[model samples]
Target: MLIVGEIHTALLPHSRPLTPEEARGALALAVGETVVQWARPVPHTASPTLLHGVDCRLPLGPKPGNRHADDAAGGSSVRAVGTVCSRAVLTGGHLLQGSAWTAVAPPQQPRRMPWSYYLARPGTLETIGNFEARRLAEGYLLADGQGKGLARKVRHDGGTALLDAAAIARHSVHDVLSRPVLDQRPPIKTGSTRLRWAAIADPGEGRAVAFRLVGNDRRRMSLVTGLVEPEQIAAAAEDLAVHDWLLSAVAARIALAKIGEDPRHTLRTLRPVVDHLLHLWSAGARTSRDLEFMWDSLERRPGLTRQWTTMTERVRSQIDYGAADLAAKMLDMMEERQKQTGGAGEPHYR
Candidate 1:
């Protein structure tokens, strides 16, 4: 089984963090469905998932000896029919994301099924032909244009069409971002980040995961874990994508500043980190503990949170602390102390 999807994350196009009410309004995509919100760790909201129906050619997995999946074309078209699921997520009321994915399963029979048969299985795509998980992963995450070649062929043949999973996700997010709820002004000048992922759940007791930057704004992560709900798997991916985006965004900004030579430039570049993104370092909050070990694994090797901690300290300890007043800085220091020692007697935000 393969769960393949794309995620788009960016700073919410707004001047200030949205309240729960406004956040809920922005993510109310479905007419009668509920929009979920969480207040504890940080202000977070999830739009009710919306499903898009698709009956089209699925991307072929790589052929033997092929380095990429996109290269494995010119074969008979493989058809898949089902619905693709998409949803909008708002974290810290400032980070926006659109997520879309479909669970791909080998077909039960060898031939095409009726429309009702496929409609009964929402969010699942049953393929009509043979394929492998590895090929699907390569095709979806590594290939430059996932399903683009197949899409063109389907169009040339005048078949149903090929689904653009990433485009579907982008549209979902853009719909929310363009709504009247947003002020059309972003606090920072940053483009959206995309994370393309494929996950497989098995009967094992442990998890195996790999995450890499395919490009500056594009990322790919593959996950394997014990049996769990599809939503749980997607949630884990979403959490990873958000933290990865935050890490990449902050790291990029920090890379432009001088460390010890120019405190002024360092402070100027990093001020946005503190004001906009530092508090969002909280990861794994939305993930299942059974699979949350993936984050721990990432932190161990690449040290996701460790790097975040180091950079946050650097930003906080910058010369003159930028425009923050002395009292606010002292309070922040005390909060950090309490965070390290449970001094506040409440849940730690970081």
Candidate 2:
């Protein structure tokens, strides 16, 4: 629903009378197929005024601040305000004897940058359409031309004025209801998980780097992080080669960022890390197999078993700490698991 504020009333065009159909199309209705009802005030017996004006409070959706942070930052606090103008015509109960009018001005247009050069940018049209659709649906009516004649007709009809008033109200309500409401929610991918990564260089002039693996939750982030180690970092520096699936995913993210003008280039530059992860997984598998043989030989001893468990956990922890990408950690875990299980099965890398 649209809750408009600051209505301006103006003189109706003195030239022509509006048809009933035109009047009916002027009333604003909320989204959906719901019918709108008008509440006219009782005429004052002592006052001889033919026209009475009122402000009808309509329920608008959530506050602008709840939807955008910029609105809150701008110091524009939205309050519950009457959006629709309600003007009543009172004439001996027959015809509307008095006239009332309200005017809605056009909305201001946003600033635009001149496109001196034509560039094929993704999501450009989609973004513009979304913005325009929202504005068209939510804007208020300023001056509906139907009010002039409807007011006069009721005044001429005498005591049956209430019926005329009802007709006019219906016409006004319909106009408000015709606009379309568009869905604003973005599309989501189901079943598949979204993984993101960031790398921060040390402020000091050093080769030290810190990496974070982000996912839907901290546990998932940590799980992905647990797949690599510092020793693996040197291998990554040599020649990082990633799987086709992971490489394509990272490439898509980079393309999206470039189109959106996102300043963060960390994701775009981290392709090498993925390559490094694939290399480590391949190298680690061989070492892991030898470790598994030693591990199985000492499995009968409880002390040795506990020691192996502690050592493996320590290795996993170090990998989580050193890896820049969560997917890389996952790849390491897959390789390790394969080796531990006697290379009998493949991991679910996807």
By TM-score, the best candidate is 1
Ten contiguous residues with the weakest lDDT in model 2: 217-226
Tell me the tens digit of each residue's lDDT in model 2 across 1-350.
11111111111221222233332232223233222222223111111112222211111122445654322123221111111223222111111111112221122223222332112221011111112212211211111121232322323534111111223333332333332321222121111111111111122322222222233211000011122331222112111111112233333433343422322343333333233222212212212321232223323433333543443343343344344455666899989999998898975566
Q: Write the per-residue lDDT of candidate 1 for residues 63-91, one digit (tens) a residue.
A: 77865544435443467777888999999
Q: How high is the lDDT of residue 138 in model 2?
A: 22
- Alpha carbon deviation, residue 158, candidate 1 (Å): 3.4
Among these predictions, the greatest lDDT belongs to: 1
Predictions in order: lDDT:
0.78, 0.24
In model 1, the runs with Cα more than 4 Å from the true position are 63-77, 148-153, 159-162, 204-206, 258-265, 319-350
